[model samples]
Target chain A: MGEILVKEKEIVAPGDVLASGMDYIPTDGAFRDGENIVSSLLGLVYIKGRLIKVLPLNGVYIPKKDDVVIGRVSDMTYSSWFVDVGYAYDAVLSLKDASSDYIERGADLTTYFNIDDFIIAKVLKVNKSMAIDLTMKGPGLRKITRGTVITITPQKVPRVVGKMGSMVSLIKENTGCQIVAGQNGRIWINGTVPDMERLAVKAIKFIEQNAHKSGLTEMVKTMLSKEAKK
Target chain B: MSYNKRFDGRKFTETRPMKAKTGVVKNAVGSAMFQIGKTRAIAAVYGPRELHPKHLQDPSSGRLRCHYNMMAFSGSGDRVRPGPSRRSKEISYVTELALSPVLDLSAFPKTVVDVFIELVQTDAGTRCAGICAASMALADAGLKMKDLVCAVSVGLVGGTPVVDLNYEEEAYEEGAVDIPIAMTPRDGKFSLLQLDGDLSKEDFEKALALAKDACQKIYEVQKNALKERYVEDKK
Candidate 1:
C-alpha cells in the first residue's frame, strides 16, 4: 500500500513528497520520482480514494477545449470577431459560429458584436499554436448585457463554483442574483437590487481569499445569511 | 590586521541588518522589496501568462525571464545610466538561472514568468540582494517552487573572510576577493556562484562555508516575509 505523506489541505511546496508507493496514483500538480510522489507547485494537497492532486494557489487561466468562458470583444474583422479570453492569444469568433442567422460575406460584423462587449462563449478548438476558436451558439453562451463583470485568479474558479456549484447556488438563492463564473476567472453577477449585487461580489471575493480552507461552503452560507438579515 | 578593524564595525562572519516585505507593488501579481543594510532592491513578478513574440514560446515548458536594472539615482556619487548595460544584462541572466531551478516550469507549458528587479540603492552587494528579493517576489506571486533562493556576499578583506562587504570594504586594496553565492536553504543546493578577483583554494573553501551560513540567516528573513503575506499572525 502507498503511504500518504501530507495531510489534505496542507500547503506544500514544489518537490515536497506527497505520497510513497505503487498503490497511489499521482495526478495534476504531482509527479512521480522513483518511489515518491512529489508536488510540482506550491498548492494544497487533495486526496481522494487512491488518487492525489494538488490545487495551485495562484496562476493565470489556460483555456482548454469546450471550456465555457467569459470574454470581451476586442476587435472585429471582415467575417470574424477577436475575443480576449484573458489568454496570450485572442480567440476568434467567426460570423457563422457567432450567431444562428446567416451573415452575408463582407457584412458589417460589428453589428452583431461590438468592441468591449462581454460575451459568454465556449471554446470550439485550441490548436497546438495556442490559437483558440470560440462559438456563441451553445446553451448558456451569448452576449452579456447590463451586468458587472469581475476577474479573479482563474485557478480559484473551481472553489468558487464548489462541488456541483453548491456555493454559487447558495449565493444566488440568498440574494436572487444571477451569477455566472467563467473558467477564465471572469464572473458576472446580476441582481434585482444593487445591494444584492454588491453582496454577491463580496461573497465571491471571500471565496477567492479563502479557497484553500475546507468547510468553506458552510462559512459562506453563514456569511450570506448574516448579511441577508442586515 | 588593517584599516580601522572593519569599516562597518561588524564581525568577520556577521552579516548586515536586513528587512524584507512582500506585495509592495500594488499592480504586480507578486512583489517584494528587500534591504540588506545599505543595499536595497525591489522585485516584481508578472505572468505564467502567454509568452509574446511567439517565436520564443517553449512548447514543452514555461520560460522564466529576468530583467535587472539599476536606477540612475541608486548608485552613490555619479548617476548611473537609465537603460540596460552589459553588466546588468549579465547579472539578469545569472539571476534568472539562479531562480529557474526552483520553479516547476513543465507545469506551465508555453507560458512565461517574468521577473523585474530594480536596484533602488547600492552598497556593493546589489546582485545578492536582487536575487534574494526576486525569489521572495516569485513566492508572493504564488509560483510553486521547490524552495526559496537566498544569497549573501563574502569578501576577503585584510586577509580575513568577511560576510556582506560594504562599498568601502569592497574597495580594499589588500587582495580583495568578492564572491556572491545563492542557494536553496532547505537542501543546501548551490544555484549561483560567481567570483571576482582571486582567492587561495583554502580561502575559497572557507568563504563558501561562511556564505552557506549567512545564506541560511537570509533565508529566515525571506521565509518570514512570505508568511506575513499568507499566514495569520499568532498574536
Candidate 2:
C-alpha cells in the first residue's frame, strides 16, 4: 500500500510530482511542492500517451530443460512438428516429448498437433542442433482449444505476465477472462466472446503503459470495467 | 520533395522502430540491451564495491569507470574487433562523465562503479544509446543515484533537428551535421558532448534545446525499461 498522488490516467509532465519513497522513478517528466520533482513516468499510470515500443526488464525467455511453454504448432514433419515460440527458431515439440505414447511410423503427426493447435508442453531437451523437444503430461499443460490470442513483444512477455503470475492474476480477476499466457508473448484470452478478447488486449496495453508506476491493481480493474461496458 | 516524404522527409531523422531489453544476462549486478532503429547496445553494471588497481581509486568517494566496446561482429561490414579504439575510449570517458553528475558516489566510499557496454549493432549514436542503457543497468543493480541519466543524438537535417539519430540519418549528411549530447533532463545538466560537421552557436543552442526535450521523452523509455526490470526483480 503506497500513497499515490497522480491518479491513473492523469496527464503528467517533466517536473510533475511522482512519489516519495525508495521506489525509483522512470527517467523522464513532472513537478512537486518543495519536493524533488520526478519525471512524468516516475510512476505508473493508465495512458498510452506516446510510447515507441515495449521494453523487456527481466531474464530473457530462454528455453531451459523441463520448462513449460504453450506454443502454436507451426510446421509438421513425418515424425516432428515445429512450434513457434517467437524466437529465432521454431521449437520442435517432437513425438518423443509426448507421453511415451505409441504412434504408427510415418503417420500424420499433424493430427497430434495439426497446423495451429495450441499446446502446453515441457522442454525435454534442446541439443546443440537447436532442436527443442517438448512433452505434455503436467497439469495445465495441455492442448488449447478455443480462445483469442494477443501477441506482444516476446521480450516484453514477462512484464505483461508479471511475477509469479501476479499481473495476469490481476487481469483475470478483473476481466474474468481465462488467459493462457506464453513466455513467448503469445497471450490467448478465453473471453466469453470477441469483446472479452479485445478487452483483454486493451487491458494488457493499459498494464504496459503504466507498468513503471505503482498501484497497478486499481488501474487494471478500472480499465477492465470501463472496457467491459464499452 | 517526394510525395512519400516524412515530416520533413530529409531522411536521417527518420528513426526506425526502436527496441530495448534489460537484464539480458545473469551473474551481473544489472544489465540492459537497448536498440534504436538499427543501433543496439548491451550494457552491464557491476560495483559500488571495493576498488581494484588501487592506484586509480578515489579515497573520498566512489569512482565510476565506463568501458564502451563494440562487438567485432556488431558492424555490418568489416567486423568490429574487440579492444578500445580512440572513439571507444573517448565515448567511455564521456559516458563516465555523464553518470558522474547524477551519481551519489559519496554514498559508497573508496569504491568503483563499473559500466561495461557492448554495442552489438552499430547504426549511429551507439555511444548515446549505450549511455542510456548503462544508466538503466546501474539502476537495475539498485545502486543509489540522484537521477537517471539519458542521452540522445540530435542531428541537423536540412536545418530541422531530430530526436534520435538513425543510420543514413547520422553519417553522410548532405547539408546537416550531428551533435551528440547527454543530459539529465530532470536536472538540466549537460554531461557529454560530441559533434560532427559544423553548426553556428545558434544551431548549437537550438540542438541542445531539442536534445533536452528529447531527453525527457527518452527518459520515459529508459524508466519503462528499468521499471520492467524492477518489477521483474520484485516478482
How does each model score on lDDT?
0.87, 0.67
Local error of candidate 1 at residue A43 (angstroms): 1.6
lDDT of 2 at A102: 84
Q: Tens-digit lDDT track for model 2 on B1-235?
A: 3223434354533344556676786766678888877788899977655576778766667789999998988887787767988988988988888888766555454567788998888888888889988877776665545577878888676666666666665554356577888887666788888888887888788788878877877777776666554455443
Q: Write the per-residue lDDT of candidate 1 for residues B110-217, one digit (tens) a residue.
A: 888899999999988999999999998887777767778998899788778889888888988776889999998867889999999887899898999999999989
Clashes of each: 1, 15
lDDT per residue, candidate 1, A93-210, as tens digits?
9888999997777777777899999999999998866778999988899899887999998989998998999888988998899999999999999988999999999999999987
lDDT of 2 by residue, A1-230 (tens): 22345555443322344554433333322323233434422233432332111122322244567766778888887777788764435777667766567888876665667888888777777664344677776677777888777665444566677778888887887667898777655677887766667777888877755555556767777777777676
- Poorest lDDT segment (10 consecutive residues) of candidate 1 chain B: B226-235
Alpha carbon lDDT at B62, candidate 1: 85
On a 0 to 1 DockQ scale, where is model 1? 0.36
TM-score of 2: 0.52
Best candidate, DockQ-wise?
1
Off by over 4 Å in 1: A1-5, A15-25, A33-36, B2-11, B49-62, B73-81, B104-111, B144-147, B185-189, B233-235
Docking class of 1: acceptable
Q: Against the hidden reference, what TM-scores do the models get?
A: 0.88, 0.52
Q: Report model 1's chain A TM-score.
A: 0.94
